[model samples]
Target: SILSIGWAQWILSDLPQDSLSLAMTHPEMDWPTAHAACPVLALAGDETLAGCVPARRRRQLRRARQAASRCGRIALLSASGSPQTFLDQLIRLHNMRWAEQGGGVLANAAVEQFHRLSLPLLDAHGLVRCWLFAIDGGTVGAYYGFHHRGRAYAYLGGFDPAYAEESPGAILIGHAIAEAIREDAREFDFLRGQEAYKYGWGAVDRWTMRRVWTRS
Candidate 1:
């Protein structure tokens, strides 16, 4: 006997006693609606939206200096760079500076909260991810957006408020462009933002169009 069953809602009333019942709390679908819906939970692979961030690289200050000798402004490139790693370490260092300036102690409990809860969310994405931080250094700000695979994106970033004058955000993004090139990603998406920093980086306006789907 050949039987074809199109499973949709679960038999909650008869949830199995064993581990099989764990998946019983399922959703219902209206066939006609399901057929027409083009929504989040059903959308296929993200071929167009995904972006990959290149590997961290080092920027040679000397090359930059040398380039300045010839061009209007010299550019330096480094492949052995780890901005995320550097940012993480810088965060602790800056926190001390903050304390020295009477920014209040970085309560151990507050840090613990970030490590346990915030960091987890940032690291959950297999393709795209972010880095969290406590503070920033004088030159290098504490920025995150650490690791990503296919179509990686810079989720969020932060810096030492005192260095706000330095535009740490701009520096982080400048380096980010090089990293994105190294990754050979199709696009470098800046998630959502209409901030000046986004514009300073020469990023253009792009919409994340959403589609609603429902089952009849």
Candidate 2:
């Protein structure tokens, strides 16, 4: 079995000690994708990464949901970026409801590192729309929202864990909603989060039907 990335790593192993991968030089894709060849051997029978994840391992759960789908008495507001007030509100809501821990972010922010990773998803989907939330001059949070069909999907994201106390992830989603309103998108999705805050923002679980193949 050969993983393309491993081959590159092996072939290019003789470079200087501080050297990087040759794939990094490709200009067609964004930096994140250009150098994103990880080692993996997808066997002949594997169509997708077919494996069962334990339900107790919450984070590994596969999800494809419409976060802003019609399912609540949603209070809508419009903007291109999320205002500071909204970030405070989500933090307050979460704090007041201790049972709602990890429901919202209060002060997390985004930096160049976050953007580097997201640029790939954007290049992968030419139509992906992104929004950034800067707090005190540093990018505290970023939302990689996807606009498809009538709704916007908040796909991948990043935030400053240093401001985790301030719930930067909440700010990112708030910005996603604002972007959605600006584009007149049908909805703004939080993608997938089990936190109660999403429910307050009116997130619903959407199950996806996946097909598995077997080789005889």
Question: Count of backbone clashes for each model?
Answer: 13, 13
Q: Could you estimate the TM-score for every candidate?
A: 0.41, 0.40
The C-alpha RMSD of each candidate to the native structure, in angstroms, is: 12.8, 16.0
Supply candidate 1's per-residue lDDT for 165. Answer: 44
Residue 23 of model 2: what lDDT?
37
Tens-digit lDDT track for model 1 on 1-216? 212444433223222123343433323411111111111111111322123211121133223233333423322222123434543544554564466565423335576456445554444543333322222212334444544543436654555555444444445555555455556544455655565544433355554332222222
Cα error, candidate 2, residue 6 (Å): 26
Off by over 4 Å in 2: 1-126, 192-197, 212-216
TM-score of candidate 1 against the unseen true structure: 0.41
